[model samples]
Target: MNTIKRNRKNRLSKLAVVALCTAMLAACGSNTTATTSTDSTAAATNTSQTTAASVQTASLDLSNSKVEYDEDDAYSDWNASEATTIKLNGTTATVEGTGAETKDGSVSITAAGTYVVSGKLDDGQIVVNVADEGVVRLILNGAEIHYSTSSPIYVEEAGKLILSLPEGTNNVVSDGTAYELADASTDEPNAAIFSKDDMTINGTGKLTVEGNYNNGIASKDKLKITGGTFEIHAADDAVMGRDLVAVKDGLFVIDAKGHGIKTTNDTEGEEGLIALEGGTYSIESGEDALHSTGGLLVSGGDLHIAAGDDAIHSEIALLISGGMVDITQSNEGLEAGSITIAGGEVHVVSSDDGVNAASGSSDTDGAAGEMPQEGAAPADMPPADMPPADMPQDGTAPADMGQGGGPRGGGMPGGEGSSNNLLTITGGYLSVDAQGDGLDANGGIAMSGGTVVVNGPTMNGNGSLDYDSTFEMTGGVLIAAGSSGMVQAVSDSSTQAGILMTYPQTQQAGTLIHLEDEAGNAIVTFAPSKDYQAVYISSPDMKKDTAYSLYSGGTSNGTETNGLYDGGNYSGGTKVVSFTAASTITWVNESGVTEASSGFGGRGRGGDRQVESTQS
Candidate 1:
């Protein structure tokens, strides 16, 4: 009798009732009536049909092909009351139901049901090989599984699988240093927990995964994580999904030799995706911290990462709507083909480039560029007050100059194809301290609203702002400080005004540089991370034909500058000089070398002035 009931349960669970209802509703019309029935019977049948049709239609529409998960569609029917309990001890396994089969050192689940698994498996495995349309839920209640030659848990065949870590439980899954599959035709599992179908992990417990072979957790299809506390240490990626990886809420700490979180599917129309709605992540990786081949969208999170390569990389578009990201160490802070920041709080400290928008995806093997040797700067860096060896001192292009009258490799290189890559900043608060270019784009840059502060490279090989095409700034506040070798201003299409000024001598780090209006109101105050000799300021508050003063060693008093109290307010300071509105100003060696002074839409060139010598 029990066997008959178990078989019946399996058969009932395998029926595709939702799909059948959808097909039936599509084959019939809403106004159809049974003509041979009585009036009451006809009315009752019509009402039933209408109700069933509406439900099926709603179900089909709700399960769209979006990367994000819908709770009602995927997790509404899970019930823990009817579940199979399995206990394991060493190489011995016991199942309390007829849905699971136990062999020598492996337990295979062949039916769809909720399962409660506990106990420690020293050298065994739990394999889920259900029917083609099965949905299984495995609840870990103080379970620990370790396999010496393969993955601890492998999902071979299933429509959807959910791994639940119940409250107050501590679960662990680990792999060994080597693996050998029994059947050569089976797909090899390279992670501690591997799944071939859609998988979801959620619970209130703590889970630890140690991947001695490859990845920590890998899903071939969509993978979603709603809740948990995870600590993962892996040889490869800590968490990887081939199709899509969506995280709603979690607390994760990852230590990886490869990428921390990654997606690598590159199908033409079905590439991989990564979406983060809410989480708290602290990652230390030898490669990129977060990477995707298709697209990456970050709406909310708190990310603190230290990476050997780029911190955040995307082959396609990368969008950041809201997050608090702090990248303390990276070669490139944020890199993408197309980058957009609508709202966020980002701070980056980089060795090569702070924010780079380029064309192609980076190599995932951490071998793109040669890393700089420890305690040594990059090659070809010019000293202060000097130009590159090949550059002419008269501001004239050399015979081997590249396009745009700049030196070779000074601007964007030619013949890189027509790149549609762009950096669009709508709203954000960004700060960058870089040893290379602060903000570089191979294509155009459009800034409508934002606040940017860049302490760019002290060397002459890079610039504070570098762009290939037009740079249109319709709104925002920008303060750029660096060496004055390859400086460019916002185009004439900008509505706000900009001033480019070069100081006579190099200002040491921690020196406050302040700008004030005629009424002694603070306008801009900045302290460069490195020594600087030039500054470019632009904002909507800058008016035409107004006199502004520059000061050094200043202490501020009134309103703050961009919510920063670095240089204090700008009320009282040691007055250096004052100048009227100008298109360009070159103050060199304590002597004013004034060039063409147009209001805001002009260009000029001047040489450095000489200081007078005093006899002691």
Candidate 2:
């Protein structure tokens, strides 16, 4: 008796009955019914016809078409509590079922076939543990399913599985979080909802995978997110895969306390690859926001990340061919085996170096650029100060550093042998605001085009001449403080000036002083007269406690004379000078050489003035 009941249960669960009353009500009219006997026969025939029309064996939808259910359609029923087992062969088909079952759960299919599941009811997690190796399509028709004990749906050893939901379905809940499977057993580490060998999610439904204590969705092979909204908050990683996790398109929001998305592969050439073609991704993570042991390429997407350590760290190359990436981090913004941003909008705010590629001791690998020699600086062009010909910066010069003018790379701090990392900025709007060296490259910096901005102390020393790095600006606008400026630069117009001074405690009745530019361009070379001889001369480059003598001869305002002589006394005829040193100097309105005396109308003219006047 028990065996018979079990068989009956299985058959009923598979062969579902369509409630004909609902279908007839949908086709109801205001016409009066015929005689009772005829009306009853017509109703029965109508029910049979409706059931036959709805039931069918079809293929899956390979084109990936879909329809949405809004608030107005929320009352409409599109679910099945039971369905007959039908083997799917193609990539397109739709399956309908009644959503009236209480305890037996939904239909169970073990065949290898591709199917699209849709409805408008709330069941528990729809389980699909397939035996054959074929694509299994699971579409939830605006229904909420709660996985109390087992996972909502389980797909085992399937060649491919596609999980989708209605486009307009909203507020679907899974233990306060939507869409995830969890097994509390301590031994099974890789346990979560939707454990499939391989799968694809293409639709408009939003799924929240929140199992921070364990994995969100464990896949033995690969998982690609072509579309949909995935909000994952996990303790380990949001998207976990034993092989590869490719994000071609979707709205992925991962707030992982650990790594945002990770893929670990033990194979040789089949390392995990995370390539982003189009979508929106926002990740906040403790370690690396987006990391893979293999290669990570962001060809096109909008990625905003806030990471505790490094925003993007990968073992291999991280190529940013196209994308809009905004990262705010504490440690480094991007660290990989090699980092190349040929095209993109990359804005990084980091405490350390904005973009760093610290090479590890794995094996002999050819980097994108020449490896920076030991005891040298980073090998990369500093941020270009010159604005790109395509896109210019917002502000103007001095204030904005203008376009194409970025911090020049002098050399990395410490020594050359520290770390041999290379950075190449062939194109893009690169903005880096760092607390450490603005642009420190061990190898070299090459500037072709684009805009790079670096604002900080170049070198660590006095404010005047203590630049930390040496810069070479081959092209582009180069703006740097202290030593961050480009090197050996010769422009069409250049201006340099300094102050000069000398003291004269007493002169031998005649003395002179000359002030000349460093290239012997004498701008101010003057000799004080007898009455004004005992004054002082000042220079801008004078150091404290250093002694200097006044030298003057044969010329004053283009006049030649001898009494203007005497390279003599300390305080007699001239030289009482004082000056200050600073990083930047601005002369408000500088005029030609003008001399003024501290003494009021010869007040300090002592013995000579008195005696000479009386004798005359």
Candidate 3:
């Protein structure tokens, strides 16, 4: 029998455990304190049936949810016969000039009707200051506005504002390095287009915004975009909304030094929210590509993001029902206090955790590599015969756990403290290539249905999957390959069979790992992005007491089998080795030694044990 044991001498004293428990309790009780906790009592009582039921009940239905905006509402109730037309050319304006006024190469509209704006205004501005309840619409037809010391278009006091770019027109708005405020007592508009009231931009034309000072487009209230083409380059946030940011359909190409799309409203009941229904977005950002303080809901879109921080972030909960998201580069791919993915196609290549569920708000300046404090028992600790320190005796997690925790103060992937924060994947197709933990949750992780493939971290300090509380996979196809030092399995509540095996020798990058049934029908196929010594495979396709074989170095020949895309499209490679699985969950070491016959349960915390390394 091949067994891995942890050294017992490394265990903490009982007093230390008790003290840690007390601290965790205090943190959980405090609303402002940031700490996570583990519910060992609940974990102990978790049966496979109950776990599946919990996942089913918590699944989200986002079919009817869509981003809503009123297109004709801007022109509603207004008489087009009484409309005003303004034409500007090189600081000269030609207009009816009734409810409109021009001064110092700037145009100001004070009435509630349609205004057709056209031509060029160099180093000038368009100010909209209507009545307290007026709605004004500006139709741009081949308009180009630029200002050296202020926003090109500034909405100072409008109830509602709409900027419409008609088809076949090309509109441009630009701002310079410094903004000159209309009054020192008033807030300065620091964007190329700044609106203080509810604003919407829609039409079928192309609009470009260049902001050398702050932002490209900023709205203090709700900002909605229905249909248009946008090219934005900004020194700060490209598109910002303080209250709500909603996008129904658009073609957006953004390059920004700060967040690409962001909302900063953190009010209790009205925190900022971002809802994206349909669009094609290509973003390169210095910070998070999509961020919201309140919550974010994505139903459908095609997003390709390269960000310095998290690609998509929400301070509260983030729900993605449908989308095609490819995060080519990010510190963390997706992060939220609680994350729910019902349906989507997501591909993440991250330097840190691929999908992280932690108890922290989005911080624009925070970088990766800051570990969270482990609030729960360490993996090196011995399994407790009694209820764990922070766990109550009732076998229920604390009520506050659902509300989530704060930051772990920096340590490792699984931070200390109790957390009810959750990572729920009801349905999705997720592929991750990570240099850190592939899937990490400070609290609990539940997956009822999904297809997950992880090419995990090469370093032993992290695992393919790390969670502080419990990981329950009632129904899913999960293939994770990485280092063996921190290898973990789904909790006892899983119904599907799993195999955790360590290769006898190092498997080079692009090596084909194939799992097949006794009759040589392919079950799963993978090609890890990095050198790997261990692999974990689980699926509903695996049957109990079924004999299966794991084969390495096989030729796939570009054929798709078993609904799985080939990890490596191999050709003409001889089989290097094979292992026969004899149990529901099999663990094999590097010496080709089988622990299945010996009834090897799972790895627990204790001390270091010697296992042969695949790396020379």
Local accuracy of candidate 3 as per-residue lDDT tens digits, 491-516: 54455677676654457777777777
Q: After superposition, how far is residue 21 of candidate 1 from its true place, in Å?
A: 35
Taking the tens digit of each residue's C-alpha lDDT, what string does model 2 give over 578-613?
A: 122120111000111112111111111111110100
Best by lDDT: 3
| TM-score list, all predictions | 0.78, 0.50, 0.77
Cand. 1 Cα-lDDT: 0.64
- Model 1, residue 572: C-alpha shift (Å): 5.2
Off by over 4 Å in 1: 1-67, 72-81, 182-187, 361-381, 385-418, 557-563, 566-568, 582-616
Alpha-carbon local distance difference test for all models: 0.64, 0.40, 0.65
What's the true lDDT of residue 144 in model 3?
A: 95
Error of 1 at 415 (Å): 6.1
Relative to the true structure, candidate 2 reaches a TM of 0.50
lDDT of 1 by residue, 1-616 (tens): 0000000001101113243233222211221111221212111111222332232222222122134454622323335457888898888789987689889877899898888889998988999989865888888889999998998999989887898877788999999988897775854798899998878988878899999898999998778888788999999899998877788888999999999999867654345667787899999998989987656767788999999888888665566767888899987788765676666888888877788766442112122133334313336545645545664443332344421122312122222311344566667788888776688765545666778888866765566776554456656778878765555555444556666656545678767777777897767777677777667777767775566777777565544543344434464457765766533222211222233221111111222222221111
Residue 204 lDDT, candidate 3, scale 0-100: 80
C-alpha lDDT of candidate 3 relative to the true structure: 0.65
